[model samples]
Target: MPKGKRKGKFEHRRTEEKIYSSDEDAGIDMTIDNCSETSGQSDLKSAHDDAENEQEKLEEKVLEMIDALSARSNAARAGAMVSLRNALQRRHLAAVLCNQRATLADHLAKALRRGRDGERRAAAGLAPLLALQIGEEGVEEFVNEIRPELAAAAADKSASLETRTEVMSQTFTYV
Candidate 1:
């Protein structure tokens, strides 16, 4: 052996082969994974936000239909009732409408009392739908709110026989 040189088969091998350290590679991989995870979470959040926005638009439209029930024109009130019924059938608005059942009952009763034949018939048609949406618990409240007007409309001789019969049948269904 020389003064500065040591004999070893492994010592020469170390200089010839590349050394791999896991720390550097792991740091880069972890950063990439973190970025992807953050982006994925953001995408999910955006999707959730879009769904909530869509639900809000639906609820607003239903509320507008409810307000339209009070329109002065008989045709408009009848149209609103039909539209409201269509919307209810298309969407499950239980959560959105549960809070507004009383207001809905009031409008429906008023329509039954003061509206023309078509409007009263449409209003009568809507009672069962409202009861269905309000579920078992709040149905009594809705029934109570509208029952008097239902009774009046059912017995009103001036209304067409069809209207009175429809009102009577609807009243029986609810009671």
Candidate 2:
């Protein structure tokens, strides 16, 4: 008897020996010749890359809107300011804006000092949120760089009392 056929009462489950010239001949599925790679992993990587690209485009658009705050048209500037406020509501977007704190502070300071009433109010509202997002270091930088303009705005007789009050409150909070 063959070695596989020698079993009696305790017969081996695989009593028949299989000879294979190829994997398919031995009843093996050869679809996945390489087990190291997975289709799901590639799909996940592609999705992640797409998300990153979309995020980058959004950041660029936000920066362009920030620059638009200096537009000559009051309507245009107001629209841009509104867009920026909405964008900054997202924490990651706020962090990205905060990373360029110097430029942001400069633009905001300019808005506070020279922009129309709506723009000034928008800048005042955004300052605290920006400070909060960037934490202590950002607050310090904002105070050091933009404080004078804020002080000037607070004292500007042309500005609405409500706007001035808001600026003063933010200044005290940062200090």
Candidate 3:
């Protein structure tokens, strides 16, 4: 057989050649052909399974971090809250967190109310992201639950301006 040619059962024949006007056209054609080869239902199912597995792992990690919020070391607790806040940025993770919004919010609120300065700051930062993850109705409920405490904290002259501002902005503005 000649180069770039194939033999059939009956006889040897020239393969049809595709002509492209530009390298970009050639690239597009190659992409289309490659895509067709991998566009089977199995490929889609496998991709979906992978996505679900990743989501599960992410959810597990977020839960672990939330548990870590109660660690004896302030640094560990602050780190966990920060991690939870970062995880909330992912929509899938956020949805998972939202499922436990009441528990999460209550825990963070306690931290904001009674923890040391660093823990309070971490809780302050995570509060808005938690509200956003829980959606409008959930956020409204959270705000209602914490509104009085937040107002008290905001008005308390002893509280640092940053802490008061965090409480007011995160609770009221976001809700």
Off by over 4 Å in 1: 1-49
For model 1, which pairs clash?
none
Looking at model 1, residue 82 earns an lDDT score of 94
- Give me the displacement of residue 171 in model 1, in angstroms: 1.2
Which pairs clash in model 2?
none
Best TM-score among the predictions, by candidate number: 1
Q: Please, what are the lDDT tens digits per residue for candidate 1 over residues 13-42? A: 978988657966566554455457789999
Worst lDDT 10-window in candidate 1: 25-34
The whole-model C-alpha lDDT of candidate 2 against the native structure comes to 0.76
lDDT of 2 by residue, 94-162 (tens): 557667788778878888888877778777777776666655557688767777777788888888888
Write model 3 residue lDDT over 120-161, tens digit each, in one string: 667877877776677765777876665665666556566677
Please give each candidate's TM-score.
0.69, 0.65, 0.67
Candidate order, TM-score descending: 1, 3, 2
| Better-scoring candidate (TM-score), 1 or 2 | 1
RMSD of each: 11.7, 10.2, 9.7
